[model samples]
Target: MSTVGLWVIGAGGHAKVVLEACRAAALPVAGVFDDDPAAAGRDLLGFSVAGAVPPPVRWRAERKRGILAVGSNRAREALATRLAGVDWATVVHPSAVVAPDVVLGPGVFVAPRVVINPGAVIGAHVILNTGAIVEHDCRIGDFTHVAPGSVLTGNVTLGRRVLFGAGAVAIPGVSVADDTVCGAGAVLTADVSSAGIVVGVPARAPR
Candidate 1:
């Protein structure tokens, strides 16, 4: 296979992790871009900051294959839509366990110890963080983040940009709505409406 030139879209901590994973996977990292102009010309893991370029400009240039490293699902989803014409790479860490029948979309990241079971469909720019468990037949929408140690039970449907906080758990067949945020250690047992932030056991909206 030809060498892949990787252009990361963020410069924060998550971008650092993704850069390291890209290096470990032997992909050539072309550079990184951040919205903060001060972050430009800085170095991240020996890769120099390549200046801030909007998704449209970057995609139009087509300099390198892109990866959405932003942690905010809404931002990621918007960027993914804007850059739909660009080639985005899916990244799976070597230690992630993805079943043969699992379908992963472009720019998805499966971190180490992540488990994606059979028939799971993960959309573009989604992040399955470390040790996250995605059970069979689950449909994870674009740019959703399944945080470290979180669990999504079988047949769950997660809407775009939904964030499950660290160690959160969702029951089987539940549907989490778009832009919803499930707080750390929350247990979700029912459907969540769009744009809601739910926390605690049974996942009620925050007071």
Candidate 2:
């Protein structure tokens, strides 16, 4: 694999973690881009924040690859679409245990200590955050976030732009629909259908 540097798309806490994973994988970080004016020109992990995200033409011309480090699924997806044609890399931390047969799409970031079991298919720009456990045959759709310490049991199917919050657990074979947000530490015992917020034990939609 060639050693090409990347420009991380966020400069906040999530981006910090993603940068660590990138370093762990020995992928150089060229710089960072955040919309916040305060973050512009700041230094993160020895890499300078290079103002806002440049136009695709500018970054692509400079041979800058990118990975979305924003935590919001919708924002990540939107920026990814906007930056179409720019090169993106799939970054996995060395500490993570990814099964040989697990399929990962471009710009997917696997944080430290994540365990992805066999036959799992992680879609584009997904985040398998620190210590998350994805069990056998799981399918996570594009722009979804499996947050820190979350556990997905066997055959779980998560739809696009879903947010599985930190420490949450989905029981085996549960299917969560698109745009659903599972709250932190919530235990999902059944399938989630609607495209809104679900919280607490049993993980029902908010009334």
Candidate 3:
């Protein structure tokens, strides 16, 4: 925790946001990596691409904390699996308001202006995106993306890999299933027991 140098994985758009977060947190980045061969040797937001990602142990031994900045849930999970040996860092933007006791798992990204209330448990690699709000006592599952401007009311339970889309709203006490996609501007009013795409006000699968 003392050493602020990070080995950042991925060089895409998500990587850009995370790099900014690192800067805001005053965490110096040691290097940047990408799975795409074409991304190597290129520059990402003034940080030179340090070539393709090496095995976690290679970098971890250098005492730098790691972050998986890929956007896709599956890709992030796979990279995390590969980088299992890494000592992960939880990136919380300085502007985000998190309760003193909020439980944030390793590799979680709390973006700018995000509000996580008391008793919330954010799972590993979850993204609480810009301006999103998680009301008290919510439990967000691993790799879930609560997109910008979304709101999860108190006690909402999200399953793994759920995409709570931008500008969406989840009402209290609803349990969303794994791999569920709540479309932008949708309102989730009930439990989604089955994994699928839901949209429109009071979200449901399109008939």
Candidate 4:
């Protein structure tokens, strides 16, 4: 397959990180696209904001492959799902350590110093942020965000759209359901269901 040149869909801080990752991988980038009028013509890491992403027709016309660089899980999912025909780029920073047996779906973004161990299954559009450690056999669902410095112990499972916050730690074999958001610095000792936000040590859902 031909190496797809990246055309980033968002021009925010997250986009900058993706651009850097692409550079680290020695992948070429076409440019950036954002809906914000003010962001148009702006430069992200020396790459110009080409223009607003046109309709599917225009995207097809250009034949430009890209990736959703949006940080928000919902926004990334919406954009990626909407432009399903667009070829999405899976970006991984050079500093990240992904085991050979790990499975990463399309549109996944793995940031600097991230460590994904053997047998981990990372779904589409998942963000494994900087310094995060995903242990053996961890399962992260689509559009989930594993925030910076977080650690998921062996066999941990995270459902779709879940957000594991910065510095949070989940114990081995625990499962967090879809859309659950764990707060920064939280230490999860048990499973967290889809209901409510979780914070603090031994992370619990506050009533």
Q: Rate the local accuracy (lDDT) of all candidates.
A: 0.87, 0.92, 0.91, 0.90
lDDT per residue for candidate 4 within 1-207, as digits (tens), equals: 454477788999999989999998998998789988999999899998987876666667777677789999999898887887877778899999999999998899999999999999999999999999999999999999999999999999999999999999999999999999999999999888665699999798876
TM-score, cand. 2 vs. native: 0.95
Better of 2 and 3 by TM-score: 3
Highest TM-score model number? 3
Of the pair 3 and 4, which is ahead by lDDT?
A: 3
lDDT tens readout by residue for model 2, 130-187: 9999999999999999999999999999999999999999999999999999999999
Off by over 4 Å in 3: 1-4
How would you encode candidate 1's per-residue C-alpha lDDT over 7-77 as one tens digit per residue? 88888889988987887787787778887899898889998888875566655565568888888887887
Ranking by TM-score: 3, 2, 4, 1
Q: Which 10-residue span in candidate 4 carries the lowest summed lDDT?
A: 1-10
Candidates in descending lDDT order: 2, 3, 4, 1
RMSD to the true structure for each prediction, in A, is 2.1, 1.6, 1.4, 1.6
Model 2: CA > 4 A from native: 1-3
